[model samples]
Target: MTTLTTTRGDITTEHVDVVVNAANNAMRGGGGVDGAIHRAGGPDILRDCITRFPDGLATGDAGWTTAGRLPARWVVHTVGPNHGAGQRDRGLLESCYRRSLEVADELGARSVAFPLISAGVYAWPRRQAVTVAIDTIATTPTKVEEVRLVAYDAGVHQEIASSLTMATSVRILQGVRALHRRGYHGLRVNPGVAPSGLFWRVVLTDAADPGSSVRYTSADEAKFAGGVVDAMTTPHEVAEQILRALPRLRPANDAPAYAAWFAGLLAAVEPEHALPVSSADYFDDTDGWEIGWNSGLRYPAPPLDADSSQ
Candidate 1:
């Protein structure tokens, strides 16, 4: 029952049994997901596929090969319909997902991760592509326990996340959907200056925000003190930077300002100086107003009780 959305991450690193590579018909690495997978998995993967796939797969076709240096044991290669050839057939793209799952079933892969097929360098419309992918996966059945749709950018990931949230809402209305837990929490962090490796983690529980308003906690006190000088010298500049730390929590149509602010924060906070923490960790029944943290956490507050916090 676990479904999640992520942006631009390697599937093999998730420790999933297999990863789907959005490969070209020839099974050769092109751009986007195909090239990334090939580069990460190493040449041995290509060597294994050389003799087995002499005839290049056709559009809407899929194949498999051993994972070379990737964490997964196998890679499911599928050729999806690229929009470039004036192709707008939704069925063709849907088949790519169906066939990819079929290949995973045959390979006995317990879990698999998917990139937004045909969306990247292929130039497929993001919204339509997401709808097709989510719909196709929702209809498909398999032994696979999990299917993760990995996005290449924040906008992409946010769109997919919103779409899934909407779909889940509809299912709930139809009495077909059930939530695992209320008050779900998610954290996205960058370890380096640029936050290249965005760490996203989530947990579902009923724990309240800790009650305390200490600006400097045990974990962050030293860092806060070290940053005090910057804050004192450039107080206005630091305030501006803090104001810019908010990310777009909702769809673009709804929160463009938040998105802009998030970008600003990403630029403002030198990743080396002040890394953001998830909201759930910031506030609580005990802690009143911890101002220095980020708010990626979604709690089931009074009016929205039982609401699924995506």
Candidate 2:
């Protein structure tokens, strides 16, 4: 499957196999992403457009040319339907992505970067533009390993990637809701603050005691957040709203004296397999006492919450 992702950067500097440009049918050069690519890629691109596509290109169709000087090997140019000019067929908007990918595949491009076609000067609604671009790229069959939806600014980048975080937070919400139905009491969806970004911490607690909890963190690496948010803040408004409407959080460090009680809880929960060692916390006091043993998930790990779907 082609991994769809978002990056907040200049598409011209993208070091991918191909950089898809949202060009006018004239194909020579234009504004926005088109002009940027042409300028960065130098005059050979214009030369290729003049020599190869003498008649320009058809709306919604795509053609490729040499990258000239850009890091990419080729540039796939597609004409997006001008929504402002009354050409509003969404199929044509979707075609910009589909045809670009098709052209990329013909060039055997394993990776490609694309701007949100028509979202700029053409004035296609930004949200709808994102939807069409992702849906078309995802449904299109190709061998491309990675496709980046490149945004020119931090805000646009966050808006594009929020679609992904919405899915993740929803899945997490549903999961905790399931455990709540299963009678698990102490629960939470919290963050582990890091320098780059936050990691997810899903805590499930003992049904009877309601104090002990087993943590399931999303060990995945941090995504590019465009430097807009992290553990202290997040661009995921849906997740924040979901968490706020859920339940009261019980801080995990509240019962540190009982840490040993939940120490072996993970093993008991999954008796069939041994859980791997994870980075945790160690407490120490300088009373001239020798360290005997140490155990626990990372400190300030997050907090637990009561069961509530609302």
- lDDT per model, in order? 0.55, 0.63
Which tens-of-lDDT digit does each residue in 168-265 have in candidate 2? 42234334444333333344323222223234334444334455443434443222211211211222332333334344433333333233223333
In model 2, pairs of residues that clash are none
User: Model 2 off-target regions past 4 Å?
Assistant: 167-310
Using TM-score as the measure, the top candidate is: 2
Give candidate 1's error at residue 166 in angstroms.
1.0
TM-score of each: 0.54, 0.56
lDDT, model 2: 0.63
lDDT minimum window of 10 residues, candidate 1: 174-183
How far is each candidate from the true structure, as Cα RMSD in Å? 16.1, 15.3
